[model samples]
Target: MTLNYYPDKPNSESDTAIYLFLRIGKETIKIKTGQYINPKHWNTKPDKNGNHVKRSYTGSPEFNVWLDNYKKDIHQLYNKLTQGNVAISVKELREAINSHLKKKEPTAVIGFFEHFLDYIQITSGERSKSTITKYKVLYKHLETFSRDQPYKLSFEAIDMRFFDLFKNYLMQQLKHTDNTLWKDFSILKTFMGWALDRGLHQNLTYKKFKAPQKDIEIIYLTEKELMAFYHAALPLGSKLDKVRDVFCFGCFTGQRYSDIANLKRNDIKGDRWTLRTVKTDKSYFVPLNRFAQAILNKYKDALRPLPVMSNQKTNDYLKELGKLLGIDEPTSLTKRRGNEKLTNTQPKFEFISTHTARRTFITLSLEKGMRPEVVMRISGHSNYSTFKKYIKISEKVAEVEMNNIWQMAEPKQEENQ
Candidate 1:
């Protein structure tokens, strides 16, 4: 393969430059040292130190297996790149190339993974926090999926059938949501495009991936439902209160579950609270509301410099609590599914979840006529569209609010004793 242009480090602070390279096999073509940008990705809150935090998807033990496979693929790719073991003869580079390298010469199928990892580490840092998280999620699948489908395979071996099945595998077999399916696809498209644009592939690009659908409802809890959730009885104890308080904290602050898991004492202040949002790096502050303050005060004895609840425990307990709340109903039927189904029906829970806290907080605030911009301050959302999406006011609430706009001048008379 030929190096069209030698990519370099972004600035003096870096020693290596990320470059792009390509390899052509007898029947298979390979693209190495490439990276792509995701157009759509959801991110988690940053750690107190302002580092990106990992995210968890909703669902169950089944999803755990999927996530594991995805991570394994990334690790494989990471090791091959950083350690320079992508091909038998591809030794470690003496210097690092911090940018994408353009390929013009016919090269051998080696060092593909190594070159790819260098790209991963470099681009991962520059992308938005959300996009970075997305890369992590999508790459995991790429890693695992590529395990069975090695890089040396012919381009013709991959077709719309494979791409289509992979889409189904992500949504149906892997139990991803409609939104998650598209998100992974979007991320994959960018990465795949990096290879295609650099002349890595003989004949393949991201445009080939098909979308499943686009009609998932923005479901969230109601104000009355939220009140019931907050006031509902749970087994009385400190440990349980910790989870409950954390969930309530999400309701009050609208921070993500991952962000809530990393909360520390110093992040709080007297009479006010502030933090840059996890998903988007936008900063915002709000006068600590009464409910939020009370939860903090109650947890004072057990407070640490980090967030209150462990994500693993909180998520598990949330499922239990959801069932207790009667919001999630039990599903008893099991049907045959291949490696391409979008979701496998699992037992449902009664109440909502930590995510619901965020959606409900924003939705209820909207119902009370809170301005979108002001509500964003508390929720830490950077834009109006995202804030609007989480606001789940039902038709009934809108009708009631609408009725208050007009009325007859005269009122019916009532007798007084």
Candidate 2:
């Protein structure tokens, strides 16, 4: 790709518009640079370096500098668009150039919130519903912060100062945990990156801004608890009963709630389920276990495979079901806010949600001596970093079991001795 400046009417004596000539392969795009010059000072012939503006003109120095910067901006935009082997059409290139030029003027640039909406609009089709919801939540928090603090939120206003202020706002004002703050920061940075790629703003300070984050405890039912919940009697066709069946299906199959909710009769082939997961869009083959198969047989005549409710409703019902099942062991969660550690303890039943079924499956599968690779395949876990957490939980369970066995055998050995 090449970019050069040319006069609209090179032979005219009066001032004429300077148009940007962008040539990519066989295609050429013309864009008005919004800079004009008299044709008398314009040079139609290109210099050795392909520069067209004559250096002998009165405004030649500044004009040349402007052209150089314009060329640099065009190339930067082209490189950003083509990075990662992305192919760009001539129309896309033109629109990108126009968007970049519009953003160059401070008055023409939209505010941070406006650009964020644009980001959502452009990415909504590619993102999941839950992800889009999270983005909107972040936007709301930022909006609240801007309003309460009476602080202007613009691209130029996002820096270390804003980071510190936002952190304090989330932690102190909103009483949010560090992990929540970290997620908001992460989302903010992602938006900034999207804006940067579009030439919306050149603020790089958000990149250096960091927030504290620590892993939260994973909540899952033990084997005894899972079995108890599965067997707990509710009205046969009640909401809780249906929720239990769906949740237990996930527990038995290690599939995600989204996948379970969307599972159809056609997805079940022979003794295995072959379907693409909702979150990752990856195909998974989950062999039918006795428990999973039984649950499916119970719902075989339903419109869908399982009587799955909305995720929010399912989570609410799960907590209610857990309470009924007496899964109320106290669970403590630790979080950080800068240098301070905050901990909250609640009944384990309160922590149970649709996702808990997935964690329960992974943890129980590992504790039951299922091979890690096999478990990962069934669970559709691609990232080792994420899968390693369940492995650690299983290891702790094994350590306790081994200690108990040693204690019992040591007593016999001592008596024999």
Candidate 3:
């Protein structure tokens, strides 16, 4: 195939739009490159009119590079289309060229998984970076799963059968937890929905595929336990001491680890703390309790409430702190995969991380008589289902709260008298 450009009209003015001509098999197709330049700067190898222009006047080097890249893109598309002796036509070529030119980064005819990753990249600025990272990780998992599949990964291939096979692979081959599998499939489903909305793929079998999730036991520190952890003395000037301060701050303020680690003095407004959440851009206002206030008072001379540390390092220190505080109670985790029920038990401290702080806040808030909606507002939770998940109410606590409710319903002693 050959690519060339010419003026829109034979006697067009100096500033006329240039259009592309593609010659294939037996047909020549016209494509509008949307590039306008002076006719005097036009270039034609051979033509009837003596307008045999060679170079453009407006920055020839840049224009030449752009033209060369455009031609290279078309040629690459042509080569990709001709692979496997596939039938090719001028209309298909034009459409392919159009698709290539429209992309922010042209690579090839993208498959399902690749296009999902591309979407993530293209909208990187609009979405949270961590969210994009999760999507990329999901893509990697999909790519690995596709390697062993009978067919290439495409939208049409993501039917119910493929869902079952993929779920089995994640369970038997990858050994993913029920929660992990559910989250991964959720991302996949989101991408598939996006593809459908954009009219990229027609097969909607994924819409009917159920992404099952078992109730995960949320492990968190109770009110007394949080106070115990708070007042627990650590070695002076130790990393554990610093991490404990930040972890307690998170528990009190209900901020995420990312937000806590990056919290600045400016974000703290007197007794009320205000800052936008990192995962979601929503802002929250949480009143600092005496415990959180005491920690900040301890570091009054510092720029922030606590010194920042890497999340991984903080978790590592937290484990040591938990062990120091004797938080080694036996805890069990159970999850269901297909016909198998998997269970694991270990010390609670082994599972404690920065996330426990937020969970502690929500659970303790509800335990302390805060309404679910109020706690949700403080925690920046948008939905009741998600808010309820973070609250770990024991049967004993439930009974006590219910009894209190009954007591409130009782008539006053003076009125009975």
Taking all chains together, each candidate's TM-score versus the true structure is 0.55, 0.69, 0.68
Decreasing TM-score order of the candidates: 2, 3, 1
- By TM-score, the better pick of 1 and 3 is 3
**TM-score: which candidate is best?**
2
| Global lDDT of model 2 | 0.85
Minimal lDDT window, size 10, model 1:
35-44
Which scores greater on TM-score, model 2 or model 3?
A: 2
RMSD of each: 18.4, 15.7, 16.4
Residue 402 deviation, candidate 2, in Å?
Answer: 1.4
Worst 10 residues of 2 by lDDT: 408-417
lDDT of 1 by residue, 345-383 (tens): 444442355676777677777777888778877777766
lDDT of 2 by residue, 1-417 (tens): 877778898887766899888898999999888777776667777777656667645335556777888888888888999999898899998899889888885565567899899888888887767788889999999999876554557897897878888889998988888888888899899999999998998889999988876766889999899998789878999999999999999999888888888888999987899979777777868999999999999988888888999999999999999988888888987777778877789989999999899999999989999999999989998888778988888889999999988876545345554
- Please provide, for model 3 over 229-306, each residue's C-alpha lDDT reduced to its tens digit, 9 standing for 90 to 100: 888878766888888888898889787888777677887778887877777877878788887888888998976668
Model 1, which residues run further than 4 Å from truth? 1-116, 123-137, 143-177, 192-215, 232-237, 305-307, 322-351, 383-385, 391-396, 400-417
